[model samples]
Target: MRHLPVLFSAALMMASTATAAPHVVASVVPIHSIVAAVMGDKGSPELLLKGSMSEHRAVFTPDQIATLGTADLVFIVGHGLEAKLAQISGSEAVNGKTFIQLSDAPGIIKLPVREGGAWEPDDDEPAPAAGSEAEGVLAFDPHIWLDPENAKAMAREVAVDLGKADPENAAAYAANALAFAAETDKTSAAIAAELAPDKGKPFIVFHDAYHYFEKRFGLTGVGSISDVSAQAPSAERLGQVRDKIIAARATCVFREPQFDDKFVQAVIEGTGAREGVLDPLGAGLTPGPKAYDQLIGNLAESLKGCLGG
Candidate 1:
């Protein structure tokens, strides 16, 4: 009878440990980095999208599906950025799991998806008005994590969700989130200094994926070779991009590492624009707590390298 109490206490401790660690899944690399940072040493979140897979074109394998099905919480960029995962997460199959949509995270700055290859000269474009898009369709650009401020907001959201899921480790999650926010602020300040000289310096991207980052640092992306869908630009679109490149005197034409650069060469030919590579998804980066900083820093370096800063 004396040993029974100790056995019961030991069993309770094991049960508490299990409940303290939640099985969280993140939809993409950046979000995964944020979630992983917030979780700190408590646990690591499973990353859904891996390698050079385009979030738009992601198709889950059986194992990934099982991961999603079993996760206690799933963090997504939302706004249809990961449509397949979003659909699966919302479906009745995963109804029991909680989804933290970063797009809806408080203090996130949302920008409407810019139209066409050549952007308007103004950066003050307003967001879509209420009821503008079809039901369940997202009209805003979903790359909300590019801005460090937005990333800070996402960290808070992740910390809150994790705290809810693992109340026993709630204080740890909150503290880790604060540390992540401080790191992001420091990184943001350094990047701002690095990019300050390049403000209003025109550049072209392979796709229109960096508006949040551009808008954050006052960098000007005059045009994109690919449209919003990342489809190869049509001949007409390419011609327009070429014209924009020359007209804007773009210093660099940035190609994404995940895609072929042949089209980029086609656009930059005779335009005197240097070709640079930008990997917004951190395709080459190993996923971890440090990835988000590297992703943003790499972008600044790529821009500076080609922009002659």
Candidate 2:
């Protein structure tokens, strides 16, 4: 105190005295969880969107950009999962910073991020111009965690990236990733077994978010309730879906965790088909240990309970 310091410079000095840990940011909850698991004590993880926030409609707040500008690494579910993430990665603040896209990782079965409508068969992929779903660009489905195998691959990639970034603690990073991968494998096996009795059965979902899930579990994506992220299907589309639901004898009508069930309920009206949520983002998802496990567990159990044994 006797040394007498300037206010601004003293503040800077105080900040300098306190160390800032390596910053890792993710675009969505699952990516955040994977990165957080890998970083463990190596870094503190920040998420741009919570579980309830739709990645498709995500916007960057000024503070979010400021935080992102300082991140050591930013994890994204690449393959055009979230268009905003690609925009952010190209920004001056993030230009050369390490941005890892999970879709490019190995062992992930990705599909074109588009919706097929009875109207035109399929629509264009979502674009970023305020409201654009034109030209049908091949955006990657960022919902990689739906398939536990992809989740394991993502964990390993996070490990490699973290270990490379912080070589001093590479061993710890590897250990965390290894442990997370093992957990993911168990989850994958459990989900497979849970749906095994109903394998090859067709089902109707609200959106196309579960393409990887269908492939993993050997089920048919009979139809969908939504035409795109921002647009709900018209009555005509719903009518076709109703016919398909009846034809497939689909026992369950699945709605996403965050969307309203009105349309799905409407589709199933008078047809004996029951409706429930199939949450990839795991709505009401608690942020703690066993939370991710519970999210997937609830999804499988919910599906089995609705569909059949």
**Prediction RMSDs, each to the true structure:** 8.0, 7.6
**Predicted candidate 2 versus true structure: per-residue lDDT over 1-309, tens digit per residue:** 011111122232345312434556777777777777777776668877775766665777888887777666677775445656556564665534446777777666666665444322333422336534222224555566777777778887777776655666778888988888888778878888888887766678887677677778776667777643434666777887898888878788888766778888889998878887787775577653345667678877877887783
Pairs that collide, model 2: 79-140, 124-136, 125-136
Model 1: worst 10 consecutive residues (lDDT sum): 1-10
Count of backbone clashes for each model?
Answer: 0, 3
Instruction: Indicate the worst ten consecutive residues by lDDT in candidate 2.
Output: 1-10
lDDT for model 1: 0.78
Q: Tell me each candidate's TM-score.
A: 0.87, 0.81
Give the best candidate by TM-score.
1
Give lDDT tens digits, candidate 1, residues 163-269: 76678888999999999999998999999999898898999998778989999999999888775446556677777889999998999999887788988999899
lDDT of 2: 0.67
